[model samples]
Target chain A: EAGVTQSPTHLIKTRGQQATLRCSPISGHTSVYWYQQALGLGLQFLLWYDEGEERNRGNFPPRFSGRQFPNYSSELNVNALELEDSALYLCASSLLPGQKNTEAFFGQGTRLTVV
Target chain B: SQQGEEDPQALSIQEGENATMNCSYKTSINNLQWYRQNSGRGLVHLILIRSNEREKHSGRLRVTLDTSKKSSSLLITASRAADTASYFCATDAGLRGYSTLTFGKGTMLLVSP
Candidate 1:
C-alpha cells in the first residue's frame, strides 16, 4: 500500500497572497495532520482532522487553517502569507489515536516560499 | 516554544563508528518517537518508546527513554554515509483519544565514509 502523498513539492508566493497545500492519506487512514518546519522553529503542529472534522490546532494564527475531506484527503490554506511563512509544510496521516495503529506516516512535504 | 530540544545541534562521525543523539522535553508524554529526515524531505519513523518502557532496540538503532528526566537518547551503531540525516525527537502529549506530536529542532548527523 502507498504511504501519505503531498502535491506541489515546491510552492512560491508573494507576501499578502494566499497558499494552499494538499495531502492524501493512506488507504485506511482516518486522521490528517499539518505541521510547519521553519528555520530554527522546528516542527510545529498546525492543524489536525479526524473523520472530516477539525479536532485540534496549534498556536498559529487564524490565517493558518485546513480541512479534511470524506476520503481522508486534507488541504491546508494560509492567508496573508508573510516571509516568515516560508518553510516546509508537512502532512501526515494515521489511524485515529487509540486505534489499531496510530504511528503517523508523513508526506514528502510542500516547500512554500513566500517572497 | 517547542516541547522537545535536541543537544549538540550537529554531529559528525566516520563510517563504522557509533553516533549518539539526545533529546529533552519539558512536559509529560505518552510516548517518545524518533524520526529521520533526509534533507527537507518527508520524515521516516525510526522508533517509538512508551512512557512505561525504558529501552527498545531495532536493527542497528537503540533507544532509551527516561521518564524521570524527561529525556531520551538514540544510538546508531555502525554508522554509514547513508545514515547522514536530521534526527528529531517527538513527544506525544495527548491521552488515549488523541495525540499531537511536538518535535524538536533536530540534530543533524553527518557520517562520512
Candidate 2:
C-alpha cells in the first residue's frame, strides 16, 4: 500500500509571503497530522485533523494553520513566512488513537526554505 | 514543549556493538513508540509498547518500558552501519477521546563498520 504522500519535495518563499503545503494520507486513513521539524526544534506538532475536524494543535501561532478536506487530504498554510520558518514540514497518516494505540505513517516531507 | 525527552543526544558505536537509547516523558501515556529516520527523510515506525506492556521484541530490537519512572529504553543488537539514523520516542496522552503523539528531539545513532 502506498504510504502518506506530500507535494513539492522542496519549496522556497520570500519573507512576508505565504506558503501552502499539501499532503495526501494513505488510502483508508482518516487522521492526518502536520509537524514542523525546525533546526534543533525537533518534531513540533502543528495540527491534527480527524474525520474532517480539527482535533488538536500544538503551540504554534495563528499564522500557522491548516485544514483537512472531505477526502482526508490535508493542507498546511504558513502566512507571512519569515526566515525562521525555513524547516522540514512533515505529514503523517494514522487511524485515530483510542482504545488501541495506532502507529502513524509519514511522508518524505517538504523542505520549506523561507528567505 | 515536547513531552518525551531522549537521553544521549548523539551516540557512536562499532557495527558489531549494541546500541541503546532512552526516553523519558513528563506525562502519563497510553502507549509509546520508537521511530527511525535516515537523514531528514520520513520516519519508519520500529516498535510500539502499550502502557500495560513492560517489554517487547521484534527482530534485533528490544524495547522496555517502566511506568513508575515514566521512562523507556530501546536496544538494537548486532548493529550495522546501515542502522545509523535518528531514533525518536513518541507518546500519546490517551485519556482524551482523541489524542496525538508527541515526539522527542530524538537520539542520533551512528554505527560504524
Q: lDDT per prediction?
A: 0.91, 0.91
* Model 2 residue A33 distance off true place after TM-score fit, in angstroms: 0.5
Chain B alone, TM-score of each model?
Answer: 0.96, 0.95
User: Candidate 1 chain B TM?
Assistant: 0.96
lDDT string, candidate 1, B5-109, tens digits? 998799999999999999999988888899999988999999988889999999999999999999999999999999999999988877533346889999999
Worst 10 residues of 2 chain A by lDDT: A94-103
The residue-level lDDT of candidate 2 at B63 comes to 100
Lowest lDDT 10-residue stretch of candidate 1 chain B: B93-102
Please compute DockQ, using alpha carbons, for every candidate against the native two-chain complex.
0.60, 0.59
- Per-residue alpha-carbon lDDT of model 2 for A1-115, expressed as tens digits? 8889998999999999999999999999898889999999899888888888888888889999999999999999999999999999999988754445777899999999998
Model 2 TM: 0.96
